[model samples]
Target: MADDSDLEKTEPASGRRLEQAREEGQVPQSRELATFILLIVGVTALYVLGRWGGHRLMHMLRTGLSFERAQAFDATGMIIALYDVAMEGLMTVAPLLIALVMATLVAPFVMGGWVFSTNILRFDLSRLNPMQGLGRMFSTHGLAELVKASLKAAVVGGVGTWVVWRERDHLFGLMLQPLEASMDEFASLVLFATLLIISSLALLAAIDVPYQLWEYHRKLRMSKEELRQESKEQEGDPQIKARIRAAQREMSRKRMMAQVPKADVVVTNPTHYAVALKYDPEKSGAPVVVAKGMDIMAQSIRELAKEHGVPILEAPPLARALYANCELDQQIPAALYTVVAEVMAWVFQLNHWIAEGGLPPEQPGSLAVPPGLDPAAGDPEAAR
Candidate 1:
């Protein structure tokens, strides 16, 4: 159970986004919306042009026929009329078809900003195994498809019933009209029916948009195990990383200890922490931390300082400050000025006392007897 929780925490969200994009055939909204607008505009323009041309052609045919023999308007004339109508219909649809084709050609670039891949059609025969294919074909998504089909059928059937009922009176009245009046009425009826069908289709498309988006996201969700597997592949095992970090720490400890003997003073937390400091009056205005470490490393630094006879001071605040702020070979910060000055003053005092005849030169804090030694350890009045 604990392992499962750890795995869940490490998963990346990018895989889910990629999967959703794949499942939905996700065209960017800007592109798809543009294409839809163009389609509507193209169809509407073509429809208006076709209606105008057809009306003019019919008007001309009627006028020409009125001047000819009554018997001349026969089956042969009707056949010619049908041919002319078919040619005009083809011309009307040609512009819409051309626009649709152009839209398809530009769809990918507009949708994706740029196309990075086109390898979706690469074939894999492994997907053709009968049992596996059948299983996929009958999966949960396949079941959801049945629901979509039922909803579409219900919407279309309901719209068809409503349209028939609403237009029944108009349809009946058109059938009873005289021939010239009947033709106008029939044209109007056909146009109204086409408009209703297009409107119904548009409504169906709007309803489908949300359902398709949800289905796409559901298909994109990765199982917990899949998430874990992807993370491991990307970042490697944690144990190996920990071991590498430990090796690096060991190497750093060796380098830090080598710099300790060159330090002017070693400050400490008495037992746990050790920080070595160095000062150069000619080069730096303040002391700098040359090395610092805690626990085993602190003990090693203290031992080296003792062997070299370097002064050790137990100042907890100074040691912590140096350890936290200073790096190897850097001058100490301005804020630590007073504390470091006090440590340096004591060292200078001890050196001065040793230089005079009144103090022992070898032992730092011991007194020594001297014959005829000046009280101030130099010219008495001048030292005072």
Candidate 2:
């Protein structure tokens, strides 16, 4: 019972599942629909061509039966008559044959579009396994097929018997009537039976179409675990992806540290943030940020600056603003021109005083950093 439940297809198929099934050439097709179409086409073709065919058939019979004096003893004459009879028979049924062939060719495409695959034609050795074949024959699907076939056979037989009983008088009188009249009545009876059978088949086809579609979808249903596995396969494992991201950040941090010693000065938020800037009048008009970091990385940048003898200035607002707005290797914003120029002048003056071995000009007392440029709001020193 547990095995049976496990085999049951409960969940709807995903788009990938449906596509895979279609590639394998497993698609919904109603055999009853094809049968109905072929029957209707055959009956209709006969109805349209019956009169013309009857005339030709009669002419052939007459020629084949007629005796000529010149051909009375000629064996070649008999051969000629036979050839004429064969040609007339071929012409007589040509339209019906063509109609049946066309119906057979077209019926499947109307259900599942045009899908031709060599996969289905390939022979598998497993198909010859006696136990498996027997199991399949007695399977639920196989039993359902057997039931459907039986019902169809019964319906067709019943209709045929009823039609024949109603036309019994015509059949019995065929021998008494002229050949042409008998043939006409026989044709009419056969056409009537065909129409009845086709109508019944159409009804069966209507029921079978939806059933086949349902069965097709059921066969393709996937379990929850299967869906999860497929999704993981497509997107990759999340843990591995997170590790990759961490490794990338580590490499970027190392590169940022490498550029810190090259910067002319380091701006800091005391202990939290650090931004390194480099200025060269010959190369660029404005100072460019060479590196920036927060917390642990900020500490590393400050240590590298001190070790390399680079100046470190405590400017919380400038440090935070540069870290927030400027990427490494990018120029600072134009709005910070005045404040940054003030800081640079102070650094240059201090450098000149130390180089000349004497007191130099007094540096600017305070920089006028922009109001909203501060990352930390309500800092009086940043705004001033």
**Highest TM-score among the candidates is held by which one?**
2
Q: Name the weakest run of 10 consecutive residues (lDDT summed) in model 1.
A: 366-375
Provide TM-scores for the models.
0.59, 0.80
Candidate 2: the clashing residue pairs are none
* Number of the top-ranking candidate, with lDDT as the measure: 2
List the candidate 1 regions with Cα displacement exceeding 4 Å. 1-43, 46-94, 98-116, 130-137, 140-187, 231-237, 281-283, 324-329, 345-384
In candidate 1, how many Å is residue 277 off? Answer: 0.8
lDDT of each: 0.64, 0.83
Q: How does candidate 1 fare on TM-score? A: 0.59
Which residue runs of candidate 2 sit more than 4 Å off their true CA positions? 1-9, 47-50, 53-102, 178-181, 278-290, 328-331, 337-375, 379-384
RMSD of each: 11.0, 4.1
- Model 1, residue 249: C-alpha shift (Å): 3.4
